[model samples]
Target: MQFTSEVIIATYNKPDYLRLCLKSIAEQSQRPTSICLADDGSDARIDPVIEAFREAHPDLPLRRSWHEDQGFRKSVALNRAIAGSTCDYLVFLDDDVILHPEALARHFSCATRGRYLTGSLIRLDADLTGRLLEAQSYGWAEGRLAGWTPKGRSQWLKSMPFPSGVMALFDRLSPVAPNFQGACASVWRDDVLRVNGFEGNMSYGGLDKEIGVRLRNAGIRGRHVRYTAPAYHLDHGRSYADQKVKSANRAYILALRKSGETRAVNGIAELDAV
Candidate 1:
């Protein structure tokens, strides 16, 4: 099935990056039915940036919403955005990232049942060193990775880089595998709602990993879109990136472990909020 819409859920305090992010979407080979950006309440300047994009792309369906800048609970804001969209598939991305013209098309092609698709994020150290891209420019595009790339070299151009076969093998063996990452992922709306949408309680990080585990527990298998669909990550020094290693975020994983509930791939729960 070809979905006419793709939702790119993003949140950031930086206005400049948000502007470029919107522009990149406008350039997609297959334009989204609607581009919705959920801002986790940012500085006053952020509003104008969003407004400017909206004005320039008046013909393109775009929606924007915000929550008061309270604690940096990305999960809650993400849920808010997801609940607001009616797209057949949702694509979550970071604010500073840029997509290749065919990024959306590649993800659409990789859609498969019981498979939660994952894509690599190419990071360029120099471009992101100063927070936002120096000139709203994308670095380079990487098809895939043999292993996880650090924050710096995620976007370096590479031809046919392989993925970590060990990681793939381990995922196939483990009951719960790591498959979810925001850089580039495509999931059905029903599958996402089945897990209650990102565990709004997770304060800073680990929400994506925990959700992937929950999906696995729910019987959905992991799928990697490596070498097929690639994206570029503009480097920024956000604390959330480093928070993956923080012990506090690990608590979110423990919460999932305690649930003992598995989501079956063949079914979906009706979300009243959705």
Candidate 2:
């Protein structure tokens, strides 16, 4: 069945990364119904890139929401996008990841009722990321690796594509926990509304997984498409990443896990009122 899907990208002042990310979206085998960019207080430069992209793809529906230059409020940015998105399905992506041609196709193929689909990203080295930023769309397919390109746990595994039959078998037999990764995840819009959307109080770490915890509590199982829906994560220094905030967020998520919380206090519904 063909579901109307919207791609929500969280971006903050990274124009180059956003440019590459937008290019990949334009090249997707299956175009998303719309593109919603949740801009977390980006500068004037980012607007030109957005305008250029809009001019380049006049047919693609693109909308962006922006707030003032506050601290890291990525969850808020995402929630605002959630409030505005009108679609049957929503795909979340960080502006730093470049996707393969089949990434959206793989994601949509895995869409099922009562479940949100999660996929993985192959982290690129600084050198490779630079190379990717310099390369054109025709040259970007190399990011999908045959083996672990950067040598991290399951990076190579996630980057590799498998036959549909083989992947279905492995996904069913796997004993590992299925986690929601924000960089590459898709869900029914109504299911997201059921959970009240992403935790707006979160900072950086485990923000996406926190939503997964709530979704599970709300009885929405996760479908893992890590192997089939591969995207390349561009490596960059996290100026916004705070270990303290991350630890706090992680602890909060664990507490939510114990409490079996199913809805976010400061999420889409709440933000919509403000």
Top model by lDDT, which number? 2
Per-residue CA lDDT of model 2 for 186-264, tens digit only, reads 9999999999999888888999999999999999999888777778888799887889988998889889989989999
lDDT of 1 at 212: 82
Stretches of model 1 off by over 4 angstroms after superposition: 127-132, 138-178, 239-245, 254-259, 262-274
The global C-alpha lDDT for each of the candidates, from Candidate 1 onward, is 0.65, 0.85
- Candidate 1 per-residue C-alpha lDDT over 1-274 given as tens digits, one digit per residue, 9 for 90 to 100: 8665666657768877777777778877877788777677776877887778788888778777567787575666777777777887788887876676667776676677677887666665653534444555444436432233544332332222445343334324444334688767778877887776776655556667777888888887667654445566655666655554457768757766688665422222222332
Rate residue 170 of model 1 by lDDT.
34
Q: State in Å the error of residue 151, model 2.
A: 2.9
Query: Positional deviation of 62 in candidate 1, in angstroms?
Result: 1.4
Clashes of each: 8, 1
Q: Give the TM-score of candidate 1.
A: 0.77
| TM-score on alpha carbons, each prediction | 0.77, 0.92
